[model samples]
Target: MQINGKTAISYHYFQRIKESLTFAATVAALLLTQLRVALIMSLVRYFKLINIFQVLFKLFTIEFGIDSSGSALDLANENIVLNELNQGKVSFVKGDATTFMKGAISENELWDLVILDPPKLAPRKKVLQSASGMYRSLNALAMQVVKPGGLLMTCSCSGAMTQSGMFLKTIQGAASMAGRKVTVLRQAGAACDHPIDPAYPEGQYLSNYLLRVA
Candidate 1:
């Protein structure tokens, strides 16, 4: 993998990928992070790179050599920041997840791999309802563009939604509504570094699921 500079992916995220994906495949990320970008680079060295919708143009510009071909969806108007940085390599779509997904689906643009690792949707119990709605909407739109029988992996940072609880159930609901079937492949929780104390059950806050979509 050709890294632009000296950015290293977290060991925790790097080792979670168990599938062997073909290089030069079309990849999309809903919520982009350094770790996810690193993983993408590692898998497909350099062939048709597409970024997620977020506030990370400069990072990807350096990593993927983003140009007109590689695009990122920035819902929170992060493109402004990228503009200020003078990073024009990436095409930043200015809209929310729903908007970007709509365009992708209408255009029949499908991806081979999809990665999702958004920020905390439900930070407090009181907002779980709203957060759940957002998650469902995001996943539903993302599902529509995933190539048939492809892979879709998402992460939930809220401890309230664990593998056996609300999170996977939420993704399942989205898949069902989108007319997509999901086969549970592997589910991951906290890394070794993040310990869950018996007294503090909420210490394990990261829930990642790798699903085979049909």
Candidate 2:
């Protein structure tokens, strides 16, 4: 309908308001949906049900010392073997691994056994290259600090890289850079607590290797 100037202006104003309200509502709905999905995923992860078998395997099989600033008793309860180690021979350094390794320990000081258990280097596909570089640097540092005839236990939880490929490359690269030769002793993974479904190899993420510095 043809309207007078004032009437047409009022009608256009209302149309603009309606369009703005629709856009705001659409954005709110998208935000709410994203929040809900994040909440659900967090809950699943918290309960460990999304990967229950894998969790169980990791808890059961891995034999490593727990490192915490607090008393080992506090963290050891999570693993029976670690608990025993805490009470017995395993050493717990209450410091960051990289810093601890770099600190005042004499160049002559030698660690017969060094365990490099860093967290997941990369969780996303896009960051794999950067993560690998980080991993290589970590290994290089560890190798420099490890004594001849000492054992280096290094690992990666980045599923983007294959276990065999990443582990071998990391050790070899580190050894080459450090001007040392390494002999692989053993390879390990998550324990019975974190069982991996044969069909779902992605669930099998932890990779460990024991190598002797030569």
Candidate 3:
């Protein structure tokens, strides 16, 4: 999906992540924070959790959605109401995600769960190198703010990056940079609705990883 011409990970991908989210809830059972460029994907994930994880959400979940675009935050707020979720439990922040992560780090604030779903950083093969560095930096910052033994669900929607098959290596670099040890608990691609042709690897444009940070 595209929001204002910006790529948004399809809601289908969120369906693939439901198990990961539930696992995080079982472990931390505290806070859930999502940093992303698109509002719909974030809202869709939040909506998906409502029915199956209703008890956990009502009693234990406090969500924070961080995005740089104010308009995106506004749309997320609207979706919250439309979905009939308790608005008071979900907070939307309008700020650069990296900056917000940095601030959270400095303030010694931490979350039990963090989702880093950035925009498509590498649109073409030529920029894949630079985009890898961006991913490393962003994930490094995000890892620092996750509570010890917490969960971090990081995603990449860049076809170039995903097809290159260097995502795990890039995340390993991020973990080293952040001075954090991470264990991959789950790995997934876009949902079954988005079929992938093995002959055309670019068809697999989404890569999601659920990591345990310690």
Candidate 4:
């Protein structure tokens, strides 16, 4: 599927998340009447994403899909109408992820879950250092906005960042910066369908981690 004019190569992660979301939704259903989720730099179809979460949870969900691009938000809205999903469940916010997180923190806003899927910050190894800083800063802000003991799903699509074997360390750094304690619940790469060749490590460009923040 094409998302925002690009082929959805990482769609597999969405499927993997669906499985986890089912379990999360089940837990939420037992404890709450609704689920609040925030997707930073989602850059995809909001309705499809919202539908997936709602269908799994079988409860009202409020999703804030934050992206900087107005066009992406437009496409997300278009997708909602195209898919016939409930429009009221999703809110598209146009803003930078870091800025949004800062605002949320100032307002003491929090969510049950937060998904940080920013665009590749470092396309080449040479820029990895600067990219790591950017990643850490953004993630620290994200951590502060997640409710204590809430779930956080973060991803780095930069091959350089993933291959450096520093993503987990980066998250630890972020936790420290945010004054939050985070425990890794799961760590994974691209889904099974997105095979990675041993000789071509770049094929393993995606690193995903699920954590519990306190």
Q: Please state the error at residue 95 of candidate 1 in Å.
A: 5.1
Looking at model 4, the pairs that clash are none
Name model 4 segments beyond 4 Å from true.
1-31, 43-57
Per-residue lDDT of candidate 1, residues 40-97 (tens digit): 2112222222232222343333222211222332321254454354444433332344
On lDDT, the stronger of 3 and 4 is: 4
Q: Which regions in candidate 3 have their CA more than 4 angstroms from the true location?
A: 1-56
Best by lDDT: 4
Pairs of colliding residues, candidate 3: none
Question: lDDT of all predictions, in order shown?
Answer: 0.51, 0.48, 0.66, 0.72
lDDT of 2 at 59: 23
Q: How far is 62's C-alpha from truth in model 4 (Å)?
A: 2.1
lDDT score for candidate 4 against the true structure: 0.72
Cα RMSD, model 1: 10.0
Clashes of 4: 0
Backbone clashes for every candidate come to 1, 10, 0, 0
Cα deviation of 53, candidate 3, in Å:
8.6
| lDDT by residue (tens digit), candidate 4, 55-106 | 4234436576888888888987887787766787778889888888898899
User: Candidate 1: which stretches are off by over 4 Å?
Assistant: 1-95
lDDT of 2 by residue, 1-214 (tens): 0111122223323432555423222242222111100010011112222132132222222222334334442343334353232222223334455554455244543443355656666787688778888778777767665556445666676776553356678668878877878887666676566789989878878776766666
Relative to the true structure, candidate 3 has a C-alpha RMSD (angstroms) of 7.3
